[model samples]
Every structure is written in structure tokens, then in C-alpha cells.
Target: MKIPSIVFALLFTSFSYSQNISGKAYYESKTTVDMDNFGRRDMTEDMKKQIKERMKSFLEKTYILTFNGNESIYSEDEKLEAGDNGRGFGMMMSSFSAGDQYKNLETNQLIEEREFFGKQFLVKDTITNLRWEVGKESKQIGQYLVIKATAYKQVDPNDVSMMRRRRDRDNEEKNEAEKKEDTTKVEDPFEDLEIPKEVLVTAWFTPQIPVKNGPGEYAGLPGLILELNVDRTTILCSKIIINPKEAEAIQPPSKGEEVSREEYNKIVKEKTDEMRENFRNGGGRRGGGGRRFGG
Candidate 1:
């Protein structure tokens, strides 16, 4: 006996919905270190060149976001690979709404719309504005409907460098000029930098969750972004857990760097340089001082 067409369709739909959506989100942020008057004053042309070369040699980093609503909990696993320090991995769990807020977990403070690579990203922001051009593509992510959309934005390298240098100089001046230091004051490093005006970035997002949120600085989509790629890295939503059986509360991460995205990048760069220098001076074991994967 042949099955009815409607029954077959229903079965196919049910099977599709039963499959959980899971994927990895990859991001490649390109940054240029300029030695011009706007950038690092102490950096020589050769040093800048070396820095650029080092950055170019970096491998892509991976972050995993699992969403299963049925479980009533949420968790995230981030694996950072490459660099001289080897491999490092971190696991974080929180209430489903944990990533939705800017909270401090461990030493890492969550921030929102922090600028990195000359563009603004919505990390843990209550409000965000992300604009993208509509495209003609549709794909299925689990049981939910998905549409592919693209957006283009320019990134300014000059702004990043200048902002970094200004922050550095300001910090130094403050440290030396103040007779009485007020360590309680919180400083925003990107205050002096203007919005970026060069270098175009394109991104793809899917609107299924009906929320304008995504990993990093991506937002403003009509739905949840399942897959995103720009600057040569790709981020795809592999699995989503909605309303899980037992409801594991998704807690925010406890250990990760917390700063404006730009500040974070600067810190990473400085740390990398320090490690490299230590290795060169034989003060650290070879390949041991730098960032290691799965740390």
C-alpha cells in the first residue's frame, strides 16, 4: 500500500524538526597596525610590519553555541586554537537568559556593542541596530524557517590604531601627572576614536528566533542568525536547545577577558608581544609562554 502524499509530507516535516540544528561559528577579524602619527608612537616601521605579519599568520578561532529550549538550560563551549601557546578550551553554562545580559563571570566581564576591527558588535547589549540588505535565499535550520540576508559595513583600521595610541598616551599621562591617583575611576578607551570609514565587511544572517542577536557584534536581524561570515571566517549555528526536558540554567561564562572589544584586542596583542619577547630573551620555555589552545 502506498502512503498518502500528506502523510509523507508530514513525516518529512516531523523528521526535519526532530533534527537539532548545530554548527560552529567562525570569525576572522583583520587588523592593521599603522606606525603613522595616529598609531603607536614608539612602534618602528619594522615592528609594525612584523606585527602585521604575525597577525596574518594567526589561525581562525571557534566558538560553539548550543540551543535546546526543551532542556531549560543553556551552555556554550569555546575552543581557541593556534598561536604559540598551544591549544585551550573553555566551557560555560548559565540560565538561558544569561548571555542576554552583561554580567561578570569569573574575571571576564561581559560587554555590549564593543568596537573591534573598526566595527561595532552587539555582545551583551540590551539594544542594538544592525542593518543588512535582503537577499533571495532560504534554508532550514532545524524545524524553524530561515532566510539568508547579507549586510555590508566598512571598517577603518586607522580609527582603531589611533584610538589605541590615544588611550595608551592618556593612560601614561594620567599615571604620571596625577599627584593623587583615583584608581576607582573606570576609563573608556574608545572615547577618542571616531567611527570607522573604510574597509567593507559583509555578513549573512537568518531570522528564525525573532530576536536581533548573534555572537560578537552581529545584531539587528529579524530573527536569530544561524550562519554568519565576514573577513574570511564563518559562524554557523549547529544546534539549538529550546525548552529542554529538565531545563538546565544557562549561566554566563566565569573566565574570559572583559573589556571593550578594541581594548580586548589591544590587551591580547600586548600579551602576545610580551610572550614573544620573553621567549626571545630565553626567559620562557620555547612555545610555552605564548597562548596555548584549550587553556
Candidate 2:
């Protein structure tokens, strides 16, 4: 039996595209920081070095993205915490960290679990749509040939973790009476921190892989994103596995109290504000051991 060439080509194409495609991408995420930004000019050089070293565990982390066609799950790869791990820092910083995140490209839905302080909240929101400017530049990330893309993302104002502390200024013009009055008024410790309205995001994606997904909240690229650079942090794919024997089930987190993203942010801000007020009123120990970041 002679098969027509076009028919054979069609069959081959169908076979190539028909199979259920699933994979896992491992990413190494790291954030670069300026030591001076810690706002600890009083610390000696050795003290600053020690602080940086301790911060390595928090600044550098591993994450796994499990995806199958239209759905994906991104979560930190679990590892035992070191005995000397910065417990206070972890508790404080983690309040700002996102837990397991699930994305449904088909429906444009985003579900994320977050543990703010000790309370759990499930943030449900629509997936962010990034207007990516695809570039002609291409590079090799591992075996994948990735092309460049850039976009600007609006920074959430309430996201204290992403905000940086503004440099303090001495008000030489203020009279002693004014200074005394200021001291009497309750002040927000995070008042100096600020997040820009928008920040540029750079991404590297490979068309060879046909999934429109990536770590964190980024997606909608023509192919899978292998590397992402945003806000002084770079998330690079260390490894990729296509069609592994055991496919992780993509499931949205459902345990925490469901709240919209805005609501969740408001909750965090309120709690943080209360903490700040307690600290200013000398009720810090009464509020519990002062676990604070951005000092």
C-alpha cells in the first residue's frame, strides 16, 4: 500500500503533537544585595560579612516548577534548615514569602498559599498579563536555546518585602520642640520603605519547549521561560526533565482561609502596622519577641 507523502507528513505531525507533555524545571533563585542597604552603618566590616553569610540561605533558594500543558505548580524545593539558620530572620522574612503557587493558563487563574506571620491565607487572583517585548537576541541556557524578552511589571505598593528603606535625613531645621512632639507621636517603622510603581523584568525563554510557563508569577511567553531577571533577583533554570516517569499532580492550594490578593496584602499590612505601633510604644516585648526585618 502506497501512502501519499502529504498524508504521511500529517500523520507524523499528529503523532508528535498528540502525546501528553509534562515536565519539571529546577531553578536556582538568587538575589544580589548591597551590604550598605541593610542600614547598619554601625556594624563593623566583620559584622557585615557575617550578616551577609547568614543571609545566604535566605537570598539563595531552589524551586521546582511542575507543568503539564495548561497548568503549572511552582514551589520551593524542601530542604532541612540548618541548626544555625537565622530563626528570627526566617520567621520575619517568610511572612512576606509566597508558598506554593498554582497557575492555570487555560483559565488565567492564579492560586497561591501564604503564611503571613503565623496565619495562613490562600490568595486567589487572576494571572498577571505581561506585555513582553520579544527580542532577537538568543542564548544557550543549558541545552535549550533561549530568546530574550523584556517587560515592565507594576510593583504592589503593599508588598513590604520588595520595598527598600529610604535613607534617613536629619531635619536640621526642626526645633527641639518639634522633635519632642515627633517623638510623642506614634510612627510607622516601615514608613521609610518604598516600592517603585513599576520595575523592568527580563526573561529568557526557549521556543523548543512549547509550554507558556515559568517560575513565580511569570508566564505567557511563547515557550517555557528558562531564566528570569527581576528586581535584583535572577531565577535560572538549572535542570529540565521532560515527560518523567512520575508526574506531579498539579493541584491548587485549598487549606488556608481564601482571600483575594488585595485582601491578603491588607491583612499583612495591618498586622505589621500593629507590630510597629507596639515597638514604638515600648510594648515590643509585650507583643512577643521582636522579630523584625528592614531594621
RMSD values, in order shown: 14.4, 7.5
Worst 10 residues of 2 by lDDT: 1-10
Off by over 4 Å in 1: 1-62, 66-128, 141-144, 154-206, 254-258, 265-295
Per-residue alpha-carbon lDDT of candidate 1 for residues 1-295, written as tens digits (9 for 90 to 100): 1223433344454444533433223233333333463333456888666544444433233344433211111223443332443211100000001122332222233453332322333343222243566555665665655666565555534222312223245564454344247544333223233434432334444433434445554555544566666533556666664435564344544334344545545543554445446444443444544543232
Report the number of the highest-lDDT candidate.
Answer: 2
Q: Tell me each candidate's TM-score.
A: 0.41, 0.81
- Any runs in candidate 2 off by more than 4 Å, and if so which? 1-19, 79-91, 167-192, 288-295
